[model samples]
Target: MSGTKPMGTDEHDAARTERLRKAMRCLEGGQFAQARVLIEPLCDDRRADVILAHALAGSGRSTRAARMLCRLAHDNPTARHPAQDMMTLLLRHSRLEEIEVTLRATLRQTPDDIRLYDQLGEFLLLHGRTDEAIEVLIEGCRRHPSALRTGNLLAVTQNETGEAQKAQALLRHLLSYHPQSAMTHANLAHILTVDNRMDEALHHHARALELRPDDPHIHLNHAMTLLKAGRHAQGWPEYEWRLRIPGRLKYPAERLLPTLRQDSDLSGQRILILSEAGLGDMLMYLRFVPALVRRGARVTLQVPREILPLAARIYGVERVIDPLRPVPAHDWHCPFGSLPRVLGQTSDIIGAPIPYLHADPHKVLVWEDYMPPRPGLRVGLVWGGASRPGVAQAQAIDRKRSMNLAQLAPLATVPGLYLINLQRGQHARQMIDIPEGMQLYDPMDDVRDMDDTAAIIMNLDLVVSVDTSIVHLAGALGRPVIMMDRYDNCWRWQSGRSDSQWYPGLRIVRQDRPGAWDGVVARVRDMLLPARPDNP
Candidate 1:
């Protein structure tokens, strides 16, 4: 041996291994600064790059660390860890454009990386770029023919974009190979539900539940499918799983009031009704309050402030308190949505009654002066509802149930109908381009609360609206409403029926296809045109 030791000598190799072991220990112990110091000298080693990047990220230099990881991933195409870390950092910062660029570049170098395609496609879909996501996933399926995950995601995106037939085919193909996958069955079930193939949807839903009995998302989907098929007897119990789903309120059952049981005798029990779900849901379920009262239970309603005044007007509610305020003591509690299940209500009982909610007589008279006092029919229009950007559920609802005010241009051609704008929030600004000679009134400014909204609805001859709280309010007041429903409407509306059992006075005009508001608006116009007092 020479006087100088070789680079691969036992002593040199042992020292290098010891150094790496200590660095890993420091990193595992959250000693990021120490780990970084130990690992920086070994940055030239390909194996040390990932550890160095993690250390740098842990030390709060995430941007610099992200750059390092991206370079590492680019240089090492076969190393999945570096690429995954880089994508994670990019996603945490919402650098979607950067992620797209980085993923596309990496895919060019390593076209066989199925995960990259899945990640890119999911990111695109989540950000509302459905068409682009579909393209990416389709390519991914072609490259990785046997990849079940990629195939499932592609089918889901396809269903979301109204390509249900394509999604159905893809899911069926996946099921043929991976029949044990719970997610695949769930995706197929959802597509079938959208296609109104309820029997087949239910079969798939049952199979999915059998595979993954504890999956809340699967249970929630099953509930919706059953409800959509007008099978409420089985649906309501499954629907209760919503409270247990992630991202929803997760208060412990013990910490909150005791849940009222279906078979419980409540002749003198003090029951609390917690207002759950959205404003529309509260309005829709308010009918059950009187039903509870009829059972001789003293009902106390906890509601949002906006609906406090209106909720207080319910005939048998002993006290109406805002949820923001201190809660009153009660023997048991039930969410508004649970009433149907507790009452064991089925579709047959949906025809019970209407006008469950009453407007303030005084306020109704006051709104009379605010009306345009025209001779023609006064129709209320709610083109949109509240939807914050970036929330998937809200975005999906807005896309399905809302339309641009300009899309309602066809309605302007119909004469003798004064279009009263009941649209609130930012969507009211859309009324700027009302067609010339169209009699339109904007009273959204004075419509302060649900009471005011109810009062205004009472003045209109017909309320034409999307599936929003206003429609529920109008229906609850027994007003004749023409609901401009989406293809995938809420469970209450059901399917293939012009009339609703929940609101007997309401007539639904739904889209034959998703995003086809033009047809819906045209139908409304034709219906209005033929029925115009001056027409025939």
Candidate 2:
């Protein structure tokens, strides 16, 4: 009790101040137990109490921390840090309803804070509560009609959620008022590019780049625009700005190659190729490693630990390193994303072999033993992509590209076609709800990573999947793959192309409308009929 209050003396007050500061320092350094011990004594102050709650949460006492946050929020609705902290904690714990209540309560007490509206709307959108997000964002825009950031978010959301006309109208209206806004131009460029309006999209992208020459995000957007339009010669340079964008990749210290040139002779150059982005991108770019090897470069490849066995089998890879460990000694290092820019402008340098990835022959033989005895075309199905809830933009794109297993249940009725499940991650639970009759050959329960997946894929006749890493793996193996694509698909697939430029055996079944997967499913199902073993 005595520790909770300062003695009525200058010496004691000074000691208390020092103690609180030390506790805050501990919290900031993530020493949660130490922070809790120090902050508990000075819990009389609201700021001290907030620190105590943070320490509790950090120490894994999330329920207790959440309760304390609720009380603190109810007592002082205008406290900025605690409310934001509570939102993050609740989101991690999936206590979503409370997040909305706390956000609304904070906004009510401090109605003039425009940031609260933005936070609430973004939270709703991240969780896929589209209607609520739209309402909140609309109200926010109405209240602060001149606010470009919120309006831009609202317009993007509208475009994604089946209201493209409304989104276009909002962006154009915002542009009429704020003609000089770089964000408005960039977002409009995004929507235009998605609709295949190449000329208009490029113009807006140029305008945005002209307005904000140093903005990495705008440059990345413009890069995607050019790449999607198949103008890769011009796009590769713009795409280099992706390295400058925030949260793209993790680099270790200042050890990377200072510069690389396309025409440089690589005779005996020790090159370390680190993964730049997603696993799919790594697969896409590993094709160029053969070229590096042919150039007399000793290529040491670092890939995701799960794919180590598979990556080790690439034709010209001198060494395969695990991604979890620190990068080993090398003369120069290059991330896979930079490979296209370094290798060539539009065309890949020669010697990137087709079917560069191969499964272990023994593993394939073992998996073949577990295959269905019935003589039929073995078709693998991957109905969903990874649900990356932590990254909002990635999650939003996943929602558009992935579909439930139920949407693909109709394929089970196809004669001489047996469906195999090749999906993992949070979405794998959909297998339990497989619509009664769709018997899936789900060897995923025993599969560890891409190595195991590749082994199993070798037993299948075809792989049908949404846009995910599996498609890359299948394509790399030179297997026939039917990719169920979104309307606004990746730049690699390009525009209006059913055949892939990268993989000869891969076929794309694209959605005609945004956020529509039924058409994609139907096309895949219809196309599979000809491939059925009993069709002839």
Candidate 3:
């Protein structure tokens, strides 16, 4: 203590870096005041500007942060952090023109920067400019020949945009050049899985796992492959890795119920099941509740309020509460998605079947005029699924699952079918664009929730929809439904089958090719107007 030494340049720099890290952690936790205090001292350091911008934004000065980030991005054209942070901020505000200008100007300033290309491609993709996004990513790959991520992005975009063969070829080429790339292997596995090439997909998945044994993403992909092929026993165990993946997990692993053995008895025990994922997932998995209830266990559901009115009446569900309520006293707590893994011993049990969900009699009567109270066959149509703006993976899936309502113009001209608008969210606006002569009965403005939707659905003769929550609602209600299945089907639909394994008698009109909904629509039209023809 008696001897004092001055801090050298390296030690001083190290101290500043640690301080910046602490500031970043504070920003992540939204302790904006503390982050600002820690970061203001480092304003002169270029590395700290993004963190400072975030701190400034969270502390009631978003405009200042935006201007600061824009200045930082313009000043440091080749730097990744400022540009990416600025892009993220611009996306949240949907300032499309400014985002394009900033990214293009920065790319011109530093054409060799790979991160700018990725950022611009992502921005374009988010805005539904898929063609431009593909071109940008392709050029990025051409320029940065050694860049793995750009090439992967191009391949994935190609796959999603109805060029599956081209995507497969590009991935194979990437593997030839970069044989050791685990991501390329995993991506190839996914494409093959979607193509129904189960054995080949499993091989690539195994290779990916061997290369990166602890990677949760590879493990999750592997799980999807096995489950898609109906290898449930193996799939369920690998699926446990989902809890370890970031963003996918809704709750902490410690709080989740431990694995319940196949033979274990929960006689008189109470269990709480927490909801996870989108409404469609909730509807699909809720069928398993009866399997749990049959074990002499009392089941409580913590779910979205939208489903509360319907879930409250499921045969075996003892109680249903909105997620805002504190989890009531229970012996075991499990994620809603976990029921299948824990209760596979009773696999044959399909729970309560055919109209497991019922509409309120009053709501049904109220909706008597919902579809023109006539003798004509009424059909419900849902052209789109839910929107998840910030979630890139989910957004990509939705693009594939959704279609323009205009494509159904062919059916608008069909005979004796009264099309009803069950479409919701931003997609419902497409009702105005339907064929001029076709009148769609829309009573959705007054509809409240799933229970209300179910009541309306019961008034229809059948439901016709894409892979949306509406399909699950119709199927679970035991209503005849024609699922407009995408070419790359979901895992539950299995591979190359017209009939559903889950919903028997559910007619599936699958696309002959990816993003080729025209074929599907044509098939559905033909089915509706069968060759038997007692008509005009």
Candidate 4:
């Protein structure tokens, strides 16, 4: 405000000008309440008022802001952009009645602003008004055929609404002109992955990485491609890049021997190993902890507060530190996953001991007392995962990849074998869908996390799950687990192999083609059917 130029000769005009500048500064600093205080009286200038309303809307004061913007738009009939912005704010925030009024009024004012139409369409899609969104976006695309954002959003809508071919066509058309568009490449790669075209997805993701080398998203996608393509040697490094990605919680910084030279001595030194990422990843990499302990380092590991009590009881570590507590001092530190690189891992050196990692016996005993006994061979089932942000986000709810509760009901009737429910969250609702006459053990109703989940898993004879964290959990425990995978299984499992470099006791049941879980399930049934002797 101090550096502001006078907008007009009068003192009032100059004062208003300075006030607007102050408001702009406040808005940029995310102090919207202060911005509103400065800008509220400046509604006399139509342009200034519109900008202020936009600031308010962005700050989550949508109701008052939307009304003010609408009024400002009405006062100046020629200001279509502000009117559109107001309508968008209404569509995003206002009640349904207000949204309808805003939409109709805005459309009547500018019947040809295709971007406005696109915004309304996107709103409709978000609110589950799919049919309306599709109709509107289709018309907008027809009018503004070159609008890349509109086309991309429309393509996603189409894909979700069961028009995969149309979505593919729209994305492909966009790619024709914007050949180097990283977003387009990523979206196309997603479609290709669903279609079982792993090679095509890999190429497009590679192209995306070339276009935006530093984008963590593209790097993650590339890592997914490599994992899916059975190139684990290169994939794990890029996968570790999540820690440095913007907006993600960074691994707690610590002083360390920045360079762990090949000849570094670690005899009797106290080391801190901090867990990063999800519960599944922590479990997956715990196999390498014993290696650190063997190096004569007294390993004190840190994990999320919730998992600390259980992790403390895990084998191979002298102590477990909950990050919520004051961080204990150590000679050197590294993230949980970085141990592989620090220990100089190569393709030849899996260095993994099956069942090397162990949870607390006390907790396992606690779960054991709660688990109900079944008649015969005990089998655990987990068909879904906690929603992950990257590639696994889309795969999180694939009914095609997961065994339908009803489809699995038949397994329950198999004599002498009991089905245990190990799946969690929204997917756990499938429990109600289980057919009568099948015994289901559901100790997970009170189980809080992987530690509890691991305890329950210890009591079961076998674990059958789709690609999920539980698969990793069961494998780390050196339990016999069947991993039912999509045709192009996750890269960690690799290609054309039943054995995994990550887990020794795991067996893979893979789909022959895209969305072909029926065959995979049938193979699983074949393997389990004979083991259940009382089936006759």
User: How high is each candidate's TM-score?
Assistant: 0.84, 0.83, 0.82, 0.74
Candidate 3, residue 393: Cα displacement in angstroms equals: 2.4
What C-alpha lDDT does candidate 3 achieve relative to the native structure? 0.81
List the lowest-lDDT window of 10 residues for candidate 3: 343-352
Minimum summed lDDT over a 10-residue window in model 2 is located at 344-353
lDDT of 2 by residue, 249-331 (tens): 45643655443455556787788998667888888888877777776788899898878888888777789987777766787
lDDT of 4 by residue, 184-252 (tens): 888878666655567888888888888988888778777777766756667667765665677554434
Candidate number with the higher lDDT (1 or 4) = 1
Which number leads on TM-score?
1
| Higher-scoring candidate on TM-score, 2 or 3 | 2
Query: Which candidate, 3 or 4, has the higher lDDT?
Result: 3
Candidate 1, 107-150: lDDT as tens digits: 66557778778877877877788889888999999987767889
Collision count for each candidate, in order:
0, 0, 0, 2
- Pairs of colliding residues, candidate 2: none
What C-alpha lDDT do the candidate models reach, one value each?
0.80, 0.81, 0.81, 0.70
- Cα RMSD (Å) per model? 5.9, 5.7, 6.5, 6.6
